[model samples]
Target: MNDPIVKVEKLSHRYSVQWAIRDIDFEITKNGIYGLLGSNGAGKSTTMNIMCGVLKQTAGNVFIRGINIRDNPVEAKRHIGFLPQKPPLHVDLTVEEYLRYCARLRHIPKQEIEKAITDVMGRCAITHFRKRLIRNLSGGYQQRVGIAQAIIHNPEFVVLDEPTNGLDPNQILEIRKLVKEIAEERTIILSTHILSEVQATCDHIRMIEQGRVVFAGTVDEFDNYIIPNTLIVTMISMPPADELRSIPGIAGVEELGGPKYRLKFTDGQDVKERIIETSVARGWRLTEIFAEKSSLDAIFAELSKK
Candidate 1:
């Protein structure tokens, strides 16, 4: 039976004196697209490699459907298919030959190999390019082949590292579509530092900062959870940071100098209106007040910025 659950408990990794990832824990239940988000070198790849058994973590463990990766590597690995940032492809092999070879490598039964190849090709939208040599295809087509290879074994969990790292905008869109289509039946772990791509395609997010998880939550929850207290206030006159802190819903204020101020407020209060009304009653001249919308890009920068 295919079970699509992955759990990482107290996951940690180090390189000599440098710590790459530390004390990260999260769980994936059921099937959906998950994005592991962080800035470059924040350890997204390190964690993914540990999960795939490519690099051994100095401590902690990963579980695939309750099977510990260290305890039962073969059985645990059989349930996972991984595509690293740079895909391994043979330049001379046609798309058809390449997929057939991948099937053999995964030890797919000879009798079912043809059906597996055809299905993965169709899912990746590479059936039209089946006869073209891998080297001859565009980056977009090559990426499709990489994805097809990962799924050809029909693994329950597919891990893709920076699947759209170098493609043009149109190619990125196509890959996102293919990722969504693939996630319908199996779980996927998408590791990337790019925010726009994750915002457009991921269902859940695990935000890694300096090799540790700063946040783990659903996409919707993350936006609301992180942004409820963030706002921008542009005014001709501003109150003292201490006075502004006393306003309902207003938890903290940072003076950006000149005409700009950043405000942090909790939900459940009309923070903007209260600020405006209070300013008017005090005869403080105002110009503009705006709430900064939460975007994956901005949120990631805030969490990972030094």
Candidate 2:
């Protein structure tokens, strides 16, 4: 098996008095998008900053391809590209100039700087805006520039914090597409509070709360954790809740809204077929029967309440 591209162990960070995060641990084993999911102040920024070598963790270690970030900061950083929550843009410089500066700063050989800038701009779909000043670009275009800078050097790992924080829906979609395209060869780690974004973009997810990882798994697995065994029902004609409750192992029939109900079951059994049989036997008018999967919003709410 290929060694992990990124490994973090017993990672913790503290502010002046309180801990920002505590004993966080996880690994990125391949080239795919990994989401550091959490709410505001959940230590996602702290963790990302540490991984990018922008900040020092109070304790523990971060390794990029077997190199410890703390012990060998420069060498470890060579394999990383970072886009912080607020982009660091030189507003006076045109898109091409800023990217050229970034390529130079990243130590792209002088001979290849122009080609690197053109390639990155093309890859990020910003070639047309190359002559536009950073401050004159739209939010979406500016974001593209930020992403261009991050990938100009073609680092092995790209760390992005809230890459789509304030964009409109179209802008959000565009950036998400850009991130996915760029992840083909780079292991990308993205931090965001947007649950739908994680569901839409990431192959695997690590949900954090209060600076510790609360859940870690594939997107489908995380859905299973929240959903377990459930079903959604919309009926035009129906039996009394107690009558449906007569079915074996059903915990409760929850009224959702209008004519819809959310059925909770015991032992995580998927009894949609049995429920269908029962409904047909009763000659009930069932307009729709959907397998219930809890929304990420619901899970996040539950986590926040804890």
Candidate 3:
């Protein structure tokens, strides 16, 4: 069987006396986009930095492919590409010049440098802007250049830290599309506090909270991590609060005004089915009934508590 592309075991880091991350562990075995999701100051950057070999961890190991980063950083780093939150852009150089320099830094063979630069530029859609000064490009195009540099060496794993942090909405969408395109042949670890960004771009998730990995799984699993307790029900004929509360699994009922009501239920109960059957039998004239989606913040809060 093929080995994992990345493995992080007991990964922890500390700044002064404060722990930035603690005992975080996970693995990436396939080619796909993985999200490192968390709030600001939730250790996302600290963890990414360690994984990319930018910062040595206070404790534990980060393995790229099969090499331990701490024991063979130079070799491990060759398989990794990193774009930090603040891009390491040399604004004075034109896009092609910067890419050439990056390719050399990645130690591409002298004869193969031009093709490497050309290929990465084409992949990142920055081919047309190759001769333009990076500082002169729009934020979206600059981001593309950033991505180009990260993958210039054709590394198998890439780490992008907040790749669309300050871009406008359209730019964000463009970058997301570009990222998805880039991930087709390589594993990408994208760190972001934006929930929608993860939902839009990542196939898997590793959610961190308060210096620890609170959850790690597929994107759909993360979305359903916290079982929804509240449901929105709209009816033509409203029932008394007492009657709605009496339904099995319903712990509470709230009148949301108009024809709408909020029903709260326990985690394991088939409250919706019961509500539908009860509404039909009693002729409450049910119009709509659906579970309330827990907000990103609420999910984060719940995971943190756990």
Number of the top-ranking candidate, with TM-score as the measure: 3
Candidate 2 — which residues are off by over 4 angstroms?
Answer: 234-237, 254-261, 267-274, 285-288, 304-306
TM-score of each: 0.81, 0.91, 0.93
Please give the CA lDDT of all the candidate structures.
0.88, 0.88, 0.91
For 164-207, candidate 3 gives per-residue lDDT tens digits of 99999999999999999989999999999888899999999998
lDDT of 2 by residue, 1-306 (tens): 365799999999999999999999998888999988898898888999999999999999999999999999998888999998889899999999999899989989999999999899999999998898899999999999998999898899999989998999999999999999999988998998989999899988888889899988888887767655677888878678997788776779998778888888884454777777888889777788876777788877776665
What TM-score quantifies how close candidate 3 is to the native fold?
0.93
Please give the lDDT score for candidate 1.
0.88
In model 1, which regions exceed 4 Å deviation?
A: 1-4, 227-291
Per-residue CA lDDT of candidate 1, range 1-306, in tens? 454389898999899999999999988888999999888889999999999988888999899988999888888888899999999888799999999999998989999999999999988988999998999999999999999999999998999999998999999999999899999999999998777777899999999999899888888877765544578887776677787888888877898888788988886368888988988987668788888777656676677775
How many clashing residue pairs, candidate 3? 0
Least accurate 10 contiguous residues by lDDT in model 2: 267-276
Best by lDDT: 3
Q: Clash totals for all models, in order? A: 0, 0, 0
